[model samples]
Target: DQQVKQNSPSLSVQEGRISILNCDYTNSMFDYFLWYKKYPAEGPTFLISISSIKDKNEDGRFTVFLNKSAKHLSLHIVPSQPGDSAVYFCAASDWGYQKVTFGTGTKLQVIP
Candidate 1:
């Protein structure tokens, strides 16, 4: 059973606009939410993350929000640029579990 899911397979956003990526999880044991960005022929790199204790976390242009009650999370990128285009994966894990479940991913295209 897939615990994490990204309903949208792809998303398109214009350059300089805001990009929103959504994720949903069914596992209540998950306590950490993470976002990873992957480019062609490259490994997925950690982008941003949010702990279950907090509702939101921001780093520069990237922000992640966790809604525990809704079992959902979202990543927001403001002033989206072409370079930001990538396949974003939403991952979740429980504290000390050292195991993470990832969503299939959402391909984001930032059009210039």
Candidate 2:
């Protein structure tokens, strides 16, 4: 069983458009949710994060929203740029647990 899931395998968006990526999780014990972006041959880089106490977090062009009751979250990029294209992963962890689970990544292509 998947503790974290990203239903969409890929997404394409035009430059300057909005891109939305979805994620769902089965574990309610998860207290911290994070998003990471990875490029080929490179390690994943942390993008944004939200603690269970918050519903939303935003930084510049990236925004992450969490709906705890539904065990769902989404990452949104406004005016996406070509350089923003990457594989995005959703991760979750419980503060008391040693394991951090990651969802299957969603490949994003921002067409210029």
Candidate 3:
């Protein structure tokens, strides 16, 4: 089965602090990973991605780490701001497969 799990449905953090979201997958054939950030009433937007060949990828305030051996991944946001509150989704896909399996989602609440 292709099941990507985001165990925590919600998380809260104060402004200017770090926020972390976790995800786990059961499928071992997945070769590429991606993270998306979605705001209310809008489609998910690509944030960062990592290849199965790489362990970590970072973009400015956001960082994603993939552990292929453990079949786990995490997204880290440094000094999260109030504007950063939104739902985050972890997605995975096999090489050459356009279809991506997404985690349920994790809502991040940033306190002002």
Candidate 4:
């Protein structure tokens, strides 16, 4: 069973528009959540993260909201730019667990 899931495989948004990506997790043990943006072959870079104790976290153009009760999370990018086009992965981890469960990933296309 997939511990994490990104329902949409891809998403397209116009530049300066809002781009939203969704993810879901099945495990209640997960406490730490993270969002990573990847370009091509490079490894995923951490974008934003939030502990289960909080419901929302934001950084510049990116914002992540977590709903523990629903086991869902979302990443929102405001004023999306062409450079924002890339793949986004949602990951979850339990305290003291070295391994992180990652979603399949959502490819975001920000059209200029």
TM-score of each: 0.99, 0.97, 0.96, 0.97
Weakest ten-residue segment in model 4 by summed lDDT: 93-102
lDDT (tens digit, per residue) of candidate 2 on 1-112? 9999999999999999999999999998999999999999999999999999999999999999999999999999998999999999999999778578999999999999
Which pairs of residues have clashing backbones in candidate 2? Answer: none
Cα lDDT computed for each candidate against the true fold: 0.97, 0.96, 0.94, 0.95
In the range 20-52, model 4's lDDT, one tens digit per residue, is 999999999999999999999899999999999
Q: How does candidate 1 score on lDDT?
A: 0.97
Colliding residue pairs in candidate 1: none
RMSD from true fold, candidate 3: 1.0
Pairs with backbone N, CA or C atoms under 3 Å apart (clashes), candidate 3: none
**Model 2, residue 33: displacement in angstroms?**
0.3
lDDT of 2: 0.96
The model with the greater TM-score, 3 or 4, is 4
Query: Per-residue alpha-carbon lDDT of model 1 for 13-102, expressed as tens digits?
Result: 999999999999999999999999999999999999999999999999999999999999999999899999999999999978879899
Off by over 4 Å in 4: none
